[model samples]
Each structure stands twice: as C-alpha cells, then as structure tokens.
Target: MEGISRTYPGRMHIAAMHPSTQEKSWMTALQHLKRKGAIMALAFLSTTTLVSAAEVTYERLLNPEPGNWLTNNRTYDGNRYSPLDEINRDTVKGLKVAFTVPLAPPSVGAGSFSSSLQGTPLVEDGIMYMSDGWGRVYRIDMTKGDRGFINWIMDPQTDPEFATGILNNRGVALYGNNIYSLSPDGAFIATDKETGEVKFRVETQQNPAEYFSMAPLAINGKIIIGPAGGDGPMRGRLEARDPETGDLIWTFYTVPGEGEAGHETWENNAWETGGSATWVTGSFNVARNELVWGIGQPYPAYSPKERPGDNLYSNSTVALDADTGKLKWHFQYTPNDSWDFDEVGSQQLYNAKVNGEDQLLLGHFGRNGFFYNLDGTNGAYVNGEQYVDRVTWTKGLDPKTGKPVEYTPNGGVQTYLPETRLDASVFTTEGADKSYCPFIEGGVNMFPTTYSPRTKLVYGLAIQGCAFNQAAIPEDEYLTGSVSAVDTATGKVAKRLDLTSAPKGGAFSTAGGLVFGTSANGDLYALDDETLERVWTFNVGTMIDAPPMTFQINGKQYIAVAVGPGGVGMNFEKYPARAKDENAKSMANFQQASTLYVFSL
Candidate 1:
C-alpha cells in the first residue's frame, strides 16, 4: 500500500492519443505530481516503478535475496536451507504466533474426508503465496506489522470428484507478473499477481482420468511440470511449457516406448501403462544445464509379478538436458521394485567431500531405505549406505555399482534377498500372507529432506518399523517414523530421533545450527542440527504435513508451516492397535483443517 498508486492521471486523454503520445502524457503527469509537495508520495511511486512485474528472473531464482523464498525448495539446488539465523536456537524459544490464516473451505459436495496442506509457502518481498488442497491460491501481505491480511484468493474451481483420494495441492510458482498453478483435473492456469485474474488456462493432460498435484518448477523462462496418478494406471512424463504463453516446448517420457533403449525392460506391454509418475518437484543444476528428477514405481504397485525386468527409469533418478528434454544419464536405485518404494522424492544437489575427494554430488534419502551419493555430472554411482535401521530388501548395495549386492545383470525377474521379497504365493489363485520390513508406506515418502552446508549433514523424516505385505490386505499394522541426521562425507546416520507415529512432514535446516520439523501428533520441533537433539517443541493441536520455511519481513525473521491432516499421515487409523500408542492416539483425536501458523520472536 505504501508504494502503490490509486490512480494515473490523463488516462481518458491518453486513451485517444497515439502510442508515443500516450507514453509522453503519462511521463508528464508523473513529473507534475512530483513537482508538487508530495515527496513521500513521489518516493513511493519511484519505488513501485522500480519494482517491475517481471521481477522473478533466472538470476534471482538462482541467488534469491535473504528474505525471499522463490521456489519450493527455496533455491534451484533444492537444499531447503535458509541463510537467516535470527531465529536460531538462542532465540527460537522466544517464538510466538505472529499470525494465522485459515485456508478456504474444500469444494462443495466433497465427501467428509479431511483436507491436507502439503505445500511449502513461497514468500517474496513481504508477500506470501500458497495454495490449498483444492488448488485455491492465496496471496497474503505479511508487511502488516505483527499480523498479515489475505490480499487475494484465486480458486481454480477444481472438481473434487476428479481427484482419486484426499485432495492435496503442493503450492504454486511465481514468474514475471503471473502465478502458475495446477488443478486436480489437469488444468494449468496462470493468474495476474495483482488482481488474481486468470490470464490463460491450458489443459496439460487430455485424458480425463489423469491429474496433477505437485507444483510447477520455473526455470530459465520455462515452466517444467511433472504428472501425478501413480496410484492408478499412468505413464510418467515431464513436459516444459513457455511461461509467458503456455505453449508446449518439449516432453520427456520416463518409461521409454517401443524401439527406445529401455523398452525391453517391460513385458506384456507394461511400458504403456507404467506407473512411474513424476509426482514430486525436482531440482536443477545450473552449471551443467541439466534437470535432475526422481521417478516413481512401476504399475500394479504391490504385484511385481505382473511386470518384470529392472524397470528402467522407475525407482531411479534421471538427468536430462534442460533445453532438449533428452536423457543425459540415469541411476536406478530399485530394479523390479516389489515394495512400492517410489524414488520420486526431492534430490539435493551440493558439493561435498566423498572418500577423501571433493565432488559435486546428488544426494537422496530413498524410500527403499538407502542414502545415495551419485556423480552429479553423469549420474554414475559414487557411494551408498543404509540410512534406516531395518533394511531387509538387500544385504547392502554393491560398493562399485551401487546396486543391491545380489543384483543379477539383465535378469528378467529379480528375487534379491529372497527373505525380504513379497511372498510369491500371496498373489496366486490360492493366496497366502507374507510379512516384510520397510512396508509399502516406505522408509520415506515425498516429504523432502534438507541439507545444511554449515553442518555438512542431511536431515530427513523416515518411517520406521516393518509391515506384512499381502494382496488386497492392509499394510498399516506396523509403522512409525524417525528424524535422522546423516553425515554426507561417510553415508552413515550420525544421530536419530524416533517417533511414535508415521511422519508425513519434512525437515528444514538453517545456518543457525537448527533443524525445524513437525510430527503427526501436532508437535512442531526445533532440533540441534549437529546433535539432532530436540531444543524446542510446540503443539499446534493438528497434524503437519508440509515443510517449514523461514523469511524476514521488516528485518524481523519469521518461521511458518502449514498444519492440517489426512494424507498418508492418516494411514495409522487403519490399524486399531495404533490406539494403544499415545502419540498415534493423540493425533487421531484431532481433525484436519487448512490452517497456516507463523511464529516470530
């Protein structure tokens, strides 16, 4: 409000003038206003004029200012580490609720199911931008002293029926003067940042059955989007579009088709409907001009017998040429994945010392219970170790090749570590049950992991415990979560904090020597980055499924996270025995609501 103008003079006269005349008239009017006794007003006008609508440039995204969170991971490298230290361990205890904004209600006629706030809020220049599970975007002004006001809300009017399960919208992207968002029914809409008016809408997916829930990644004037629908029959692909015009530029399919290099991995035309959905936002390597993304699991999630061979791209991380959409290299973590361990989680790119040598590495805390450190330039395997306590899938990864120790090259069907494999008899005409560790819920899900340069450690929220795997039988009976601090130099977990319930949220580390995260039992935690010890905890009386972010407004630092419930966090309710656990019972007692909480000293 300080730097914005109410009206521009000579608007009606300029309407009938030529282009050059209109420009001259506007300049003259501004000069006349400045000549008058309105220095403060003129200063405000100059500041507003200097702030162009197209402020989110590639350089700005690569090197974001201290107070802005331009992308989902806060930067192109996906580190999720804030440089701000005002709210360090020394001052975190002084944190109090700065403000709270309740998100819009879910779509009408939607069932009684709960809503989830899964997206990280993006803050730029004292304005916060976030979206709800129903694809409604909100722009809130955080410059209002201790409290903020919702500047505008843009609802895409997403049809709730189109979404398969509990609705979840990750967040939105900002570029130039438009904010890009995706609907549950596969529509990509661009809205005016000032008025919240729809500028253009394009249908990204033609199939009525396919939809997307993840946020779009803005890079080099292009918008890169990954599709969801991993739970159903869907072939995964990544597409790039012109951010300004919404025109298709190029598309890259994760699962190769016939005549392609990796087509032979699929049998019975399984590649056509392969469920390697790219459901999560990926990281970018500006130096190499490569887009590194993680791919999900193959189709028929639990029944690996239906599809065979080392499913090429699924359960892998692929690096493609950002300009041409061509695959440069890929490293598959799980071949012939039988446990539904999707590798479609965020990848953190950083330079680290590995085995006595400094190398640019791509790190991932995989759902399959392993921490991988790969060559960022070529996707070559460098080092990997089990980051979770119980990894029965394999004895360990082959140090040289980074594959399961028992992996057989070119094998049609894999039975690595047979003891941990799903029971073959369970899927037959006469079904039997088999138990497995690191169940289908995974050692880690889409919740992002953070890397702190100061501590040289990676922090993650990992699910602990094992579960029984049988066809059509629920697998939530045995599960829990943990917060782990892994040393990057030696792929070993230095410390761990176990949770009594499954964790759906991720962690955010800062230079302040602190790590911020939330638990399913409604407790927000601030842990020591080096020791992984809890320094502070606040119970907000609801579940937290999104990552925490920090920003500065008016020179005061603030921390914020969206709190709600009912995503994978609610899976514990299916297990009646979970009621016996205090944490699980406490989380079950609270209902989900789309509310965002911001705290400051």
Candidate 2:
C-alpha cells in the first residue's frame, strides 16, 4: 500500500481505500490526463500563425498611377517619358506656369544657387518631393488645396559653412519607410517622407575640402553612395550600406588596390587616390542583380601624370554584383583619362530586342563625347558611336575593345612641362593646362543625356567647342572630353547636334515623341523625338546644369527643371564667343538663385 501510495494523486487521496482500489484512482488520473491533453490540443488549434516573410515586387515600385513618377528617369527605361497624354503635343503649347517658388540669394559666396534647383522632383500618390539648390527638401501636397499647397519644408541648411555653394542635391530616394538624402558635406540623412521629421543622419564621406552633393540611391534595402572629390587628391570609391542602420555592406573602389587585378594600371599608389567616385545616381536591374553606375575620372582636373595606366574603372560603366559589391565587368569609355569627363553620367538600364534576342542594355552619354549601349549582363560592348563633331582624339572606338586606341595611350598628363607646381616636401605633383579637348571642366559639365525607348533613339545635347590647352603628357594619358551619341542597334551616329553652348542639365526624352533639355543660355527646348527638331522652348533667365524631370498630376502633364548659375555654362553666357578678354574668367560672375519652377497644361 505504501509503495502504491507513492504514485497516488495528491488531490484524489482515498486514505481508507484498499490497494486494489488504487486502480480506480489510476482511472481517475487517466481521465485527468485525457482532459489536459484535450485542453492542450484545443489551445494549439486556437492559434494560427504564418511563417513566410513579406515580398516586395517591382509592380509595387512602379505604380500604375499616371500621377506617379516611379523611377529616376521617370521610368526604369530612362526615357524620362510620361504617358500622361492629357497635356499632349496639342495642349503643351498652352502650358502655363502653374506655380513658382521665388528665390533669394542664400549667403554671399555660397556659390550661385541662382536658379540652381537641380533636383528632379518625385511625385507619389499626391505628394511631390523636390530638392532646392541649397539641399532644402520641400514636400508639396498635390491634393491639399484645390491647386495644391506646401505641406511642409525640410531645411537641411544648419551649417552654412559646409555648403559647397551649389545646392546640387538631385533628389531623394524613397525606400520602405524612410527617405534618404546626401548633404553638401557628405552626410547621408534619413527623414520620414510622410512627416518632415529627421530619422537619422550619418556621414557617408568625411572631407571638409572635398564636398559630397548627391541624392541617396537605394537598391535592395541598401543605400549606395560615393564621394565627389574630383578636385582633391583622393581616389573615389563606391559604397553600399544599410539604409536603416548605417552599416557598410561592401565597397568597390574605382581604382584597384594592392595586388588586385587592375592595380597594375596605376602609377605608384596613385590608384589609392584615383578619382572614379560616382557623384550622380545609379540604376539597378533586379532580374540580373547588377547595379550599373558610371565612374568619374581620376582628379587633379588637368594632370594625368600623377595617375597612370588606363585607370581601369575610371570613365567606365561598371556592372557590380549587387549582393557582394564585386565588379563583374566594366567597359571603359576613356582610359588613362585626364579630362574631367567622368563616366559618372546617370546610367540607364533597359531591355529590348537586339539580334532577335532579348538583351539587357545600359546606356549613357559619356562626358568624353560618345553614346554607348552595352550588354548589361556582362558589360559587353554591343553598340557604340560618336555623337559629336569635334572628337579629335580618335577616329572612333574599336567595337571589340570599346576603347579609343590613340586616345587610350596618352592620358593628357602634360608631363612635358617642367615640375612647376611640385611640392617636393610632400612628394606631391600638380601640373597646369595638361588636358586635351574637354578639359576636366567637361565639354558638358555634370549634365546627363536620356535614351528614349519609344523612339529607339538616344537624345543628347552636346557642346561643339574645343578646349584651348592640352597636356602633351604621353600616349598613355588618354584625356579627351566632349558629348556624343550612338545608335544602339548599329552603334552609329544617326545625327550629331552640336551646340555653341556646352550641354548642361541632362537630356530628357518622352514617349510623346519629345525630348526635353536645358541649355547654358537659360533656354529649355523640347525636341521631336523622331526628327530631333525643336518643338517648344522656354527661357528661365539663368543657366541650367540640372537634369529636367517630368510627371503627370491630376491628368495634367507637368515639366520641371532646376536652374543654377555660376556653372561652367555661365562662363559662356557672360562671355560669349566675341567677349574681348584673353584672360577671361572661365567661371562667370557668381550669383545665388534658389527656386523651383513648375509648368503644366
């Protein structure tokens, strides 16, 4: 009985029962166990859970709303096309200035913000996110008032000293719940897009003298950013970091490092400070998982002797592994570049039929006077041709190599001159006027050309002029700068439209058979996509060096362009061809104009 008592249920004690009666207790215990099991089963069935992560689709990214501006070029195809035909060719002439953000000079010597509104606004739902020249973000409510009103303003201008005098933020990138932007001094700031509240800010690059001015480009939950120290002694590098935590995922230096594949191209440790930083925006192809971006040139503006070899990745369109930041392939447009013509134009990615196969294409109007269409899959040169008349560096590029042979050898480093600006104490070498056509200032300065998929033609505005001085550096100093285009199918120039004024503010081609671009003379013209003839024009009364962006709001087509003076184009505007001064100022009078002009029909 004592032994059996050890297993008895405490609450069901039967002190006076016989040993055989324990069977009855066991039966009661079994009943209790059954009740517990049933209760547990009922609890388990009551709870239902999902075990899959949420998915983000391209359809969610590219909304179907005609009022939305989805991708950077208005669409991933980079045509800068808006299908909102409510303001078609018939009604575009009646397009009137709907609203204007008036301007007042920021601080003196803050660099001319005068009309320097370079950002291409992004519209979603009913909100317009636009950046002014001074790194100021304004949220305009397209649905607020009957005509729309300012919802809120985010002014990131606390430190006026850190200003590069150019409020050149291209715009902001929206991912998940945050909006990312880069300050003039290189801080990547995140803000709540819905509310004008600052979430966080971190320095992407740190150099007081070397400024950083570009909008954050987000891809695959990472914010990819690079510095803009083209005039400094540092080589540029591209970086990918966590958009929320600011943790670095990977980095791809424009120039190779020690014992790396492209390290042999650099002279000494010049590749260490080589300038291929991408200051503009980049594009990604989700299906291929490749981020396509144009690398800037090695700096020093004029001298190439400091940095040598083909400068592997500089002035090249690089296809990088989005997951690992490893360089998959690169097509260098200008090697051993001395011209400030950075390959850093906005790289546009798309897919079309080529040779009867659906091939991915990446296009750009290289500052060095050419338009290219390369296989986005492996960086293969599919098509390339001259888009300018005054490209004296080479007759043309070898289709197989995608390089200009004669121009590839001598990278415009003017080593022939005596070491006049050498700092022996620091072992630093600096030379003057050692660059060829299209100096580091660019035949086209910081302007982008758009490729229209609808017309099957790439549209670009080019400068016809040539640089006066050239560095007779070496056959290895391949420095040539100019603007040009190419037919993707044949890699031939369909036509070359060269302007007396250099191309500023990139080009935009639309699906409505129109191409829009701004010039240094403060004139904005729309070209017929098929004929490349002027269709419409507007004078903003100041130079424009920003890419124009278009979208549809409320069934009305709207066009917007940022105008900023004190750019290289301002030099030609103030001092025309007949301006009498041998030692004329290359950079015209600095004036500050900070405003955004919106027109619609």
TM-score of each: 0.87, 0.78
Q: Model 2: what TM-score?
A: 0.78
Question: How much lDDT does each candidate structure score?
Answer: 0.75, 0.59
Q: Which stretches of candidate 1 lie over 4 Å from their true place?
A: 1-54, 107-114, 423-432, 469-478, 571-583
Instruction: Output the lDDT of residue 474, model 1.
Output: 58
Cα lDDT tens digits for candidate 2, 1-601: 0001011111222224443667667544654553122110000010112121122234645543566774455654445656555555555576666676554344322444322556677766656677655556666665431344554555544245555434456777766665667666566666666555666556554454445666666666788887776556666778887776666788888878987778777776777667677777777766777778877776554456666577778888888898899988888886765556687776777666788888778877667766777887888888766665556555567767676655435443332213221212111233333233433344454566677667666666665544442233332322222224446666566765544444567777666766778765556777666666666778776556677777665566777665655443443234222122232233244344555677776
Deviating ranges (above 4 Å) for candidate 2: 1-59, 62-64, 107-115, 144-148, 158-167, 352-358, 407-435, 438-445, 469-486, 496-500, 571-591
Evaluate model 1: give its TM-score.
Answer: 0.87
Q: Considering every candidate listed, which one attains the maximal TM-score?
A: 1
Q: How many residue pairs clash (N, CA or C atoms closer than 3 angstroms) in each of the candidate models, in the order given? A: 0, 33
Highest lDDT scorer: 1
lDDT of 1 by residue, 1-601 (tens): 1112222111211222355876667545754553232211110011121222346788888899988888999988888999999988788788889888887654421434445688999998878888887777777777764766665666555555555544667889988777888766666767766656666666666444366778899999788886777656888899888887677888888889988889889887888888888878999999999999999888766667778888778999999899999999999998988777899887999888886889999989889888888899998888767767787878888999999888887747798877667634333443345556675556777888899999888888887766553344453454567888878777778889887666667888887889998766667889989877788888787667887889988788899998866544554333212422555554466766778899988
